[model samples]
Target chain A: SQQGEEDPQALSIQEGENATMNCSYKTSINNLQWYRQNSGRGLVHLILIRSNEREKHSGRLRVTLDTSKKSSSLLITASRAADTASYFCATGSYNQGGKLIFGQGTELSVKP
Target chain B: GAGVSQSPSNKVTEKGKDVELRCDPISGHTALYWYRQSLGQGLEFLIYFQGNSAPDKSGLPSDRFSAERTGGSVSTLTIQRTQQEDSAVYLCASNLEINTGELFFGEGSRLTVL
Candidate 1:
């Protein structure tokens, strides 16, 4: 079973526009991490936010976690055409084997 | 000196044939994982191995799928009597330990069952 579900299965916007994707999980987690996957390629780690943290930033990427709501969001500021790809949120639970459970993912397209 | 690595970047096998996929984790990484991704779909957890501890095989879709890790380093996923529906990209990832949630993924092996 999938632990997380991402909203807006697909999104399209201009290169300079900001892209936002939301994810909701079904269980308590030690942390939530986001990954990016180019077509036909392996996933790349983007950001991780621990349960105690409310917000985190890496380069142009911003992530927020609302443990009370059991949801998280990733914001890519000033997006580029190269940023077009599939974004997934993986939930890691301490009680589990630390194996990540992934969401369906959001496909973002940035038009030049 | 490098990231996780998988063999046979692409594979084409006929239905009913058995196939094996391999993964080489980064040196000293004790945790290895296998996942499957269909076209335009998120990854599905397949199995997990942590050092010498019992492998967590609960995520495996069926008994036809089995995996083994040797010396807590390299791992292999074997699918017997493959079916056309088995076509998907098999991904391998490694993490330091159970506490570190971050995973480093390798270029997956794209398997197409004919």
Candidate 2:
């Protein structure tokens, strides 16, 4: 079963614009992490936000987690063509015992 | 290796045949995971190995799918009597330990079942 569900299955924006993607999950999570996949092959870890923390930022990426809503959002400021890829949100829960359940993912395209 | 490594980047086999895929995680990492991703689909959890403890095989779809991690360093995923539905990219990832955060993934092995 899928724990996380990402909104806006696909997004397209011009370079330099801000792109936002949202993910909602069920059950209590110990932490939530975002990953980027290019060419549908290897995935790179982007950022991780623990349940105790509300927001975290790394470079142009900003992540916010709202446990009350069971949702998380990823905001990419100053998007670039290189950022075009599939963004996935994975939730790690104690009940799962260290396993991370991934979402359907949001395909983002940054037009140059 | 500096990162996770998977063998036979691509594989093609006929239906009812068996295939094996291998994964070598980064040195010193104690946790390894296998996931399946269909074309244009999200990753589906397959199996997980943590140190020398028994693996969590709950995510495996059926008895035909099995994975083994040798010496807690290298892992192999074997599928018996493959079907067309089994065609997808098999991704291998490894982390430091339980809830340690961040998983380093390999380039993935693309499987095609004819």
Candidate 3:
């Protein structure tokens, strides 16, 4: 079953603009991961944020986790056309033996 | 393999037919997974195998879906008595361990039932 729900089912933004996507999950998670899928193909791992971490950054990508709210958000700064893809948030808990429950995903289109 | 590899990138078959999808995870990766994606349902986990032993198969929707891994390296997902609704992309992924977070995915097998 899917545990995460990503807001803004679809998003469109101009190149160099910022893109932000939010995810809310139901149960407690040991960690959360963000993945990007291009052309409905294989998913690429972007980043992983543990339950103890509040925020993390990698390059232009920034992810914030609010365990208190059972929510997380991904922010992309200076987005480019290549950044366009479907993003998914996966929630992982130790109780599940490390299996991840994924969200439906948020489709982002960056127009150049 | 440098990354997860899935065979029969595309499969087309009639209803009631059986289809087999193969997945080769990165060498030494003990964790493997199968997921299904369709128009109606999003990405859904079907099974998870850890070194030839599946500890989690609760995500499998029905008895028609089954999977196995051998030598802790390669895995196969078999769908029996396939229905039109079974048409979807079957994805394979792997990681170093079941407890690890990083998952490497394959290109996925696109199944079309006609």
Candidate 4:
């Protein structure tokens, strides 16, 4: 079963602009993770936010989690054309025997 | 291996036939996972293995879908009597331990059933 649902199935933005994607999940989770996937390739782990933490950053990636609302968002600042890919949110629940449930993903296109 | 590896990057088979997809996780990683991705969709968790024992098999769509991990390093997913609906990219991922936030994924095996 899927635990997360990402909004805005597809997004297109000009290079150097910012891109933001939102994810809403059901049930409590130990952590939430974001991933990037190029066309027809494997997924690359981007950043993870623990349940106790509210916000985290890595390079141009920023993640904010609001456990109170069971929602999280990913922000990519100064997005580059190379950043064009699909982004996904995965949630971890110990009750599920350590399996990660993923969202449908948001397809992002960065145009120069 | 340097990263999680999946073989038969592309496979074409006829309906009613069986197919085997293989995955080799990073060395010493004790956890392995199998997921399916339909075109324009997110990954669907199929199964998880912890040191050759699958504690959670609820994700398996049907009895036709089965997986096994051997030596705690490599795993195989077998689909018996494959159907066209099974045509999708089968992905494998691994992590150092259970409940880890990050997972290492493979390039995935694209399967097409005709």
Candidate 5:
């Protein structure tokens, strides 16, 4: 079963703008992670926020996790044309034995 | 190797035939995963392996699907009697351990069943 669902299935923005995507899950998680995939190929890890962390940042990527709401959001500041890709949120729980259930993902297109 | 590696990046096979996809994870990584992605679709978890423990096979969609990880390093996903519905990109990923952090993914194998 899918544990996470991302909102705004698709988003288009101009370069230099900011893009925000949200994800909600069904159960408690050990951690939530964000990944970027370009051209439907390999996925690159972006950031990971543990259940105890409310927010975390790496470069221009900011991720926030709200365990109470069973939700999380990813914010990409100063979006670039190169940042155009699909972002996925994955939830990892101890009961899952290390398997991370991913969301449907948000496709972000940045126009130059 | 420096990263997770998958072989036969692309495979075109006839329906009812069996196909096997391979994955070689980053050296020493104890956790590996298999996921399937259809065109424009999110990943669907297939299976997971952790160390020498019995793999978690709950995510596998059907009896036709099975996987095995040998020596806690390499894995192979086998789809028996493939159907058109099996056509998708099979992705392999590995992590250091359970809940340790991010996963390293391979380029993935694209399978086309006709």
Candidate 6:
């Protein structure tokens, strides 16, 4: 069973726009991490927000976590064409051997 | 130093045949993981190995899938009697013991079952 499920199966926006994607998980987590995947390549770690933390930022990426709702969101500011990729949210449980269970992911397309 | 590396960037095998995928973790990394991703789908956890202790094989879908890590560095995932459903990109990742939760992924091996 997948622990997390991301909303908005697909998204499209113009360059320089802000893109927001949401993820909902089933259980409590020790931490939640977001990753970006380009076509025919591996995933790249973007940012990680601990359960105790409500929000985190890395460059243009902003992530917020709401443990009460079991949901998280990743926001990309000033999006570019290169930001066009599939974004996934993964949850790591404190008791689950630190394994990350990934969500279905959201495909974002930024057209220049 | 290099990050995780997976051999045979691409592979094509007939259905019912066996295939072996290898992963070379970053030097000194103690935690290694394997995942499978289908086209336009999220990554699915397969198995995990930490040091010389027992591996966490709970994520393996069936008995046909098996993995082994030698000396806690190099790992191999073998799939027997491969089926079309097995076609996907197999990814390997590794992280230092202190931060086992942060994974550095490899380019991945794209497997295509005919």
Taken in order, the candidates have interface RMSDs of 0.9, 0.9, 1.2, 0.6, 0.9, 1.7
Q: Candidate 1 on A1-39: residue-level lDDT in tens?
A: 799899989999999999999999999999999999999
Report the backbone clash tally of model 5. 0
lDDT at position B49, candidate 3: 91
Candidate 6 lDDT tens digits, A57-111:
9999999999999999999999999999999999998677758899999999999
Candidate 3 structure quality by residue, lDDT tens digits, B1-114: 688999999999999999999999998888999999886345898899988899989988899988988888889999999999899999999999986888999999999998
Residue B18, model 3: lDDT of 92
Docking class of 2: high
Compared with the real two-chain complex, what DockQ does model 2 have?
A: 0.80
Fnat of all models, as shown: 0.76, 0.69, 0.67, 0.88, 0.76, 0.57
Question: Between 1 and 6, whose TM-score is larger?
Answer: 1
Which scores higher on lDDT, 1 or 6?
1
Q: Sorted on DockQ, highest at the top, how do the candidates line up?
A: 4, 1, 5, 2, 3, 6
Candidate 1: residue B81 lDDT (0-100):
95
RMSD of each: 0.9, 0.8, 1.0, 0.7, 1.0, 1.2
lDDT of 3: 0.91
Q: Compute each candidate's TM-score over C-alphas.
A: 0.98, 0.98, 0.98, 0.99, 0.97, 0.97
Could you tell me how far off, in angstroms, the CA of residue B27 lies in candidate 4 after the best superposition? 0.2
Instruction: List the DockQ of the predictions in order.
Output: 0.82, 0.80, 0.75, 0.91, 0.81, 0.65
Q: Each model's C-alpha lDDT? A: 0.93, 0.94, 0.91, 0.95, 0.92, 0.91
Q: Candidate 1, which CAPRI tier?
A: high
Docking quality band of candidate 3, CAPRI definitions: medium
Q: Write the per-residue lDDT of candidate 3 for residues A1-112, one digit (tens) a residue.
A: 4799998889999999999999999998999999999985899999999999999999999999999999999999999999999999999998878688889999999999
- Following a full C-alpha superposition, what root-mean-square deviation does model 6 have from the true structure? 1.2
